[model samples]
Target: MAALAPTAQAGQGDESRLPKAHSWRQWLDREAWRKAIIAIPYLWLLFFFIAPFLIVLAISAGTSQVGIPPVIWKDTFPFGTFDNYVFLTQDDIYWQGYLNSLRNAAISTFFALLIGYPMALGIARASSTWRNVLLLLVILPFWTSFLLRVYAWIGLLGNTSWFNRGLTSILATFFPFWVTGDHIQMMNTNFAVVLGIVYSYLPFMILPLYATLEKLDRTLDEAAMDLGSKPWEVFKDITLPLSLPGIIAGAMLVFIPATGEYVIPSLMGRGDSPMIGRVLADEFFQNRDWPVASAVAVALLAVLVIPIMIYNFFQAREARRGST
Candidate 1:
């Protein structure tokens, strides 16, 4: 009886040592860890993204000068003048750059969508082993440096290059009247710029589309076919509707960066059709007009952000509807 009593007391002691029902403090502690995790990205954005933009906005409102940093901030609060922003309207080049950027980005995004949709659909429909292989092939170009790829395009489009030579040969054979002895002027044109953007941004378009399509319920497609809907009708009604999110995601991914792209346009575009990015570069680097460059950068962000915010609003609404 004495030994049994000690064992019972020991068992009670062990039970007491084990964790009890979580208290409010424990619950709060558990949530603190989650809050910490959530805070990391917000803190990063605060320091890196939002802070830099605020600095740029401040600089944009400043005066242009011949010194290092180039911007002269106001001594008083509000920190600078609105003259630089006003200049964006008065200066035809800056406004024209914005228009050219929008046009080029829109065209490039359309072509990227056209090319990428089929590739993404094919990947989604492929056997698992082949899907991975195909995806690898799509992303293989990224293994090499982006600059090298653009430079290779420069070589390909050059007058004496093999691509141009082959193209010229085909033209000469097919339509002798259109073919001149002079090489095809593929380099330093909007065609090259569009081509470069389409090629570079195509993967961005494909990956998101593939992700969405892969997640889609193929049973819905099969059911639609069973109901006597034609394959094209099924695609239009079932597949395309479900894939709109991916389409928007891919388009934004390609379009946003393409709008602000500097390297592709600089390497491939004519001087007359400078994109907003190139204008920003020339203003800051060549012309040493920091105020104007900062204003252009801020305006470009403002223009791009409106569409993004709209997309976010729609996406959130859709998510809520789906959850319900």
Candidate 2:
């Protein structure tokens, strides 16, 4: 009886171990690697974006104070008394900031497209050696610090600078009276801001455009040309349509950052009604109004993210329809 009892106990232990071994095998399934790899980006976004957003949102609901942190976190509501948002509506500065930022960003994006499209097209058409050289030239500015590039523009556009002096000399031939000033009023204006933005972000616009243009089927262009299509017609009909994705991508890249830009506009633009980023900075640092700053930050996020989300939704819908 004792021997039988021992055998029964051994049999129970073996059965118990079987499930654990099966679970261990299942855990090592091929899909486990894929899941781990796919989790990386999601984890990155969660940590960088979601966590910081929640912290900011919490602070937005708090009242401003004369403290080191300058914010009084509230457990009441994550959006404060909503007075900050109301204040934004009541104030002209906030509206001006938003409008000016959008206008500048849009204008810069347009100019970038006009300049970048031809460059991208030429690069795409170039031989491999020239293509590499041109690409290096395009990205060479990035080797220097961005701040240094913007400061270089400052020197070039400043009232007493030789570049402006030369520009004045050239313009005097066309408009002698208007060019009476020693240097053009290029600096301390939206022109400088736009120029800075375009210079800094033009590479962003070019790279994506080049990527798209390079992938286009040369045969289609050749066929169209053979059928008595003029170069302009072929480009307008075929090239433009195919490169729309790159255009949109480049525009978004330029527009989004330019809208929130602080340095260029602050250094060069009129300060009476600065961009939203400048406004947000002033509220936080100068005004010591943390709650208002947070509100501005949140509204800025919404302004940027909401449109993107809606656009993505519609795009996904279109893609699904096309797939169907």
Candidate 3:
């Protein structure tokens, strides 16, 4: 305390201390601004996504009495019982529809994957311009109205329509034995529904596979070739393993929502060809049973959530394995 510090030492200490404080203050300001910016999107998602789901959850737990409102919740608790779920279990129609939806989705996803994989591979191997053009063609269908496309399929599959008529005429000319009667009715058949689902969801499968395949290392293929592996062998050993994530992702995308699809089935299937989506819709509108519809929806969500979670778990596991 009695001796004064050297001016040069004092100046150095002040310089270091001042800059550290200033930098920290600046960092705090930036962080505050960044947090403010982030808060906007977080708030928006909370209000939009979380709020709606909560409302649905609330409604699902409620019941519609004979004279009361459709959804009854008293004192912020679900006064209504689990009658909806019980009804669903008792109803053979609901169970049948659920199983049928799963079957249709699985079949449609299989076909979509079979067709889309080759298309995606072709696109990935093409030159940039050609790839872009092909991709445009793939997506071009979406530019038109979805309803119109479904309607067009109806026309194409109709017994007297150009497609079936042309096929019938050509087959009759070449091989009469192969050709059937005057009309070949594909409309209102399971085949038509499958076709519609595949057509609608094929692009979804293709684009993801293409993106993944395009980013894959060509060196892996070259190495497999150098190792005296055949093309199919190389694909099975190298390409397929590496592209598994994309394949799973694409399959999940097409399969999950397709299980609950309504529009395509309505357009192409018979009235009795009940899918979960159709049943859910009917419960809401035709039957005027909100609680039951909500229960059906919750069940659908539960079914989808399990597969999605499994897919995500596998994806994460793969990512961790890759990282290590």
- Candidates' lDDT values, in order? 0.93, 0.90, 0.87
Cα lDDT of model 2 overall?
0.90
Runs of candidate 2 with Cα error greater than 4 angstroms are 1-29, 73-79
Between candidates 2 and 3, the lDDT winner: 2
Tens-digit lDDT track of model 1 for 1-324: 777887777878689765667787786779878999999999999999999999999888999877776778888887779998889999899899999899999999999999999899999999999999999999999999999999999999999998999999889888899897747999989889999999999999999999999999999999999999999999999999999989999999999999999999999998987999999999988999888889999999999999789979997999999999
Model 2: per-residue lDDT, tens digit, 185-252? 89889898899999899999999999999999999998999999999999988899999999989999
Which candidate number would show the highest TM-score if scored against the true structure?
1
Clashes of 1: 0
lDDT score, candidate 2, position 244: 95
The whole-model C-alpha lDDT of candidate 3 against the native structure comes to 0.87
Model 1 quality (TM-score):
0.90
- Cα error of candidate 2 at position 123, Å: 0.8
lDDT of 3 by residue, 215-316 (tens): 989999999999999999999999888888789889988998899999999889867868899999999889888888988988888888987789789979
Model 3 segments beyond 4 Å from truth?
Answer: 1-45, 66-69, 74-78, 171-179, 314-324
Q: Which should have the higher lDDT, number 1 or number 3?
A: 1
Predicted model with the maximum lDDT: 1
Model 1 error, position 10 (Å): 9.5
User: Ten residues in a row with the worst lDDT in model 1?
Assistant: 16-25
lDDT of 2 at 242: 96
